[model samples]
Target chain A: MTLNDTDVRAVLHRATDHLSSPDGLVEGVRRGGRRRVARRRLLAGGLAVVTAASVAGVLQFSGTGDERIDVASPLFDEPTRGDLARDPAFLREVTDAWRGATENAELWLRGEPHVVWAGNTPKGKAAYVAQRSLDNPVVVQPEGERLIGYAGFVVPTANGLRVLTFEQFHDSGNLDGNSQAVLLGPDRDTLLVLDFGHPVEYSPSMSYAPDGRIVRQRLPVTFRDGAASLPVPPQLTKVTIAVGRAPMSVDSRIHVVNENEILFPDGKERPEPRRFDYVLPGADRAWGAAVAPTAWPPGAVAALAPFLDSIGTHVVDPEAPDLTVFGATPDGRRLLVSTIQYDDDPGHAVAMLGRGESEYPVVATQPVDWAEPLPVRLRLPDEQGTLVAAPEAKLEYRTGASGTWLDAGRGAALLPAGATDVRVTPASGVARTVRL
Target chain B: MRDVRGTEFDDFVRTRSVSLLRVAYLLTGDRHAAEDLLQEVLEQVYVRWRRVRTTPEAYARRALVNRAANRWRRRARRPESALGDLDPATPDATDDVALREAVVGALRAVPPRQRAAVVLRYLEDLSVAETAAALDCSEGAVKSHTARGLAKLREALAGSGLVVTIPNGSGSSR
Candidate 1:
């Protein structure tokens, strides 16, 4: 049976008619709103102080060019940690090693590096250092001392303490704080994630099968002095760091790191590139490069004005170059497509099809990376069949789950009338069957 | 003394929240995300209650659409695979479950702007001009987005073997 616009509206109503505003929604909004206002006020007050300081020239460099101003870091006030906390000689040696490692470093060190935590790991002796540096002047602010540090595992060899790996830590002012995880241990099986602000939980890296099934392994993270570490399970390719406790909210900060990239001590080798069934058409472009904007189609501009206007709301600079491409479905419907690439973040694309003179309806929008792009599916308005856009993949379709696969056109094809699924086999990878 | 503005805000929430939540549900395609998005928008509305009380529903809607768009952009930045773990949709069965799921899934695939236009125009039954006002774009743009959005919905439904008829005399007006 065919559905109509009225039927579609009925379906939407039926789908959402059961949803009611939860109790305490108003109270929650009020509470959150008050906090938001308070935060805004506090930020405004802080901005005033910074402005006043700038007006008074308090932020300007005050000393002569050759004079060195050494201010002790606040971290020095905090007591040290670990088994060698009271061992002055051991502390001195770690401090010396830090100084030597950073001696010729390009960072502007305003004060000496101090070892704040020295502990024994399964791998070897490890030390965490905190130093005063002017690497980020904005963060340094009125006090003029910004904390930049490094943590590493040290092993004693024939000569002396060999610094296995020293991972530098600095905040990019990301309000969420800075975190770095390194793989250590003799077999590189220990994962140490050092967070400067808050403790975080982690899950072993996940791998996605060709069929989009995810295999994830969870490991408990043990936290000690703002550092979380876990034993990396064998064949773990990556790790995902998440903040907060159980039942984490959707907005919780989560980061995925390829384990091979952080192989502590000797992190010089790069891992092999991951293979996917379908890669982006032009994945090699240097991010943030100037992309020539699609010359707006005069015929399609009126229909796309809202999309174009909405771009500014999503991107940092609406004036920056954006790339938009135009294509067509199997039914010869014109489609205007644009990839929403902003900054270094991965993005999705917008595709609107021209239908009946000036009506341009959106047909398909999907992510540009990570997810499988094979069996490129685009449904044409009014049952014109699904348009598959795999120029190099062999295509087959079936009318039912157990139906026989029938050969479909190459490059692109409209699914056969009443087809339920399509099998897409790329030039090299395994064939994937996508439900229509 | 009674806080008149607070009472008015409470009344607005009590009266209009159900409809607004439905819009949010269609926009985000996840119940939890929809609730979160609605509450966040309501908070913004409450903060600006004095200025927006005049047209609180419209303001709330505009805020919802924009917030949903921003949320989509943020979600897009994460690895696409990670998205499945965030607020998975709860299953709800109904007589029209297959058709509803197909329609909703298809709508979720549309771009944020186009989806907003469709939800506002088709689902909420807003006129082209009203949708344009809420989207803060030109009427012509509204026509284009709604048309394109509807076209996508139609195509997606058709591919799922559910043919949907376009509204009578419904085409983009030049």
Candidate 2:
């Protein structure tokens, strides 16, 4: 029948009830547990499977020439005089200001699992410049009334101050606090963020607006979780300190919904540990010994390298390296993607992600789902570019036609500074019609 | 690792269970798929509770949508489960149960995305902007998806020769 608003609601109610049902909740956890454990083992072991191409031995990056030129971000390519890229002087000034604000912005360092944004001076040069981990990000303008979602990167400038790597639709979408990010007022001290009120208090993802403001802040809270709180200074009552070579910290305030505090250590924030790990049995046959410590650009690999190998004990990868399902899938060989600020980009020279591993230059593709849209420079001829989407879902893809250009997949996943390589892949099996 | 997410998440399941179950059912098309979908979402939520902002329902919903989309991505992925009595807890299901079943039956007649659009737009009552945001597409996409979804829903029902009169107001709307 023509499902009316009520019918629609009824259907949703049914679906949501099913999702939130006791049985459903139990099962979701079971899967997560299984997946997480498997993944952690793979990541730690450091070996994943790789195999020779059936016909062609090599999978070209983005299926394009290795010497591809970096195209201006499609979102900001049309820079008008007043646009961020338009006025040289204004841009320089902002850039310089960003530099000054982030100077001494040591706290902006992006640690894995938990990224912390803190600064010594609120109005100083380093105040807003400390967070370079959350790279180019965009808020989805808050999803369901109850859920607001945002993603970005915090990268440091040459001068050392961290700045929001505002990328993609974020320039247009109102992300509030994070969009119009700048150390404000006198001496450029205040790190201002525009934030919209989310229904829940903590455990939610935070989004920023173009002008460096936090527009939507959904804690995705549950009354049962605990006393609601925000991700602010004092509100950071507790910090999950993963102590190791460096400390990884998270705001305990995020646990506002969970009344009873979960057990995490207190001290210098140590790096967050991998949730799970495993080794692929046929790792040797796939990845040659020369491809030691096989590291692709960010956004590559479906899960832990080893984990994928185990699925079949023989199938190296199903998707392919640097696969941005949304990007150029012409032959589905290569993919291109971006990285986050602090976590991946090592340019800041402030090491994060334990072992100082740069997580950046986001690649494309994932085991679960391929990300939307590929970079402009990386599409194929006929498949050049288009947005592939499911009817009413935010799930979509934009990519090039050819296999030679860069393709960004979903898990290139809004990253932080220290994020690297501009391009990477998830599943190494999926191939593209690589060029050059 | 023993899941530390029990206490709080459990409470969420106890209360919002009705709503969660409903959404799960919508995404998967059957009780079994719905349950499986819900379970998968819950596990993911549990693992990343802190990052997920402690809202089990929110996490569960995101996962459910994602999982449903993943399942749907593979045309081979079809629901193998069946829905029980409409009320779930009670056997009082009647004409409404049949109507609900009919809605789902009609729903399958449409494309997956369109079906989701109808559910999110009309059923979930998601605003145009919110629907687009949740669906992760442009607002234009949401509008188009909704329009197409509604048309397909209508056609599906017509094929079944079932007519559902929509009342303008009153408790019937609920």
Candidate with maximal lDDT: 1
Q: What lDDT does the true structure give each of the candidates?
A: 0.56, 0.35
Q: Write the per-residue lDDT of candidate 2 for residues A1-436, one digit (tens) a residue.
A: 2445555455445423323345445444644553443333222222221010011111222222112212222112222211122334544544454444333221121222111122222333221111122222212232211111112223334544444432112222232222222223222222233112233232122232331222232223322111111223221322111111111112111111111111121222234412111112222233334112445423344222311211110111222222222122223223223211111111000001111123322222211122322222222233323222111122212233322333433332222122222333323333322111
- Which residue segments of model 1 deviate by more than 4 Å? A1-3, A46-436, B1-4, B81-94, B162-174
Clashing pairs in 1: A205-A238, A360-B148, A361-B147, A361-B148, A362-B148, A362-B149, A380-B155
lDDT of 1 by residue, B43-147 (tens): 888767778999999999999999989987888887653334433445655345565566668887788899999888767888888888899999989988877
Locate the minimum summed-lDDT window of 10 residues in model 1 chain A. A48-57
Error of 2 at A390 (Å): 36
Please state every model's RMSD to the true fold in angstroms.
Answer: 24.1, 24.3
For model 2 the local lDDT of residue A341 reads 16
lDDT minimum window of 10 residues, candidate 2 chain A: A347-356
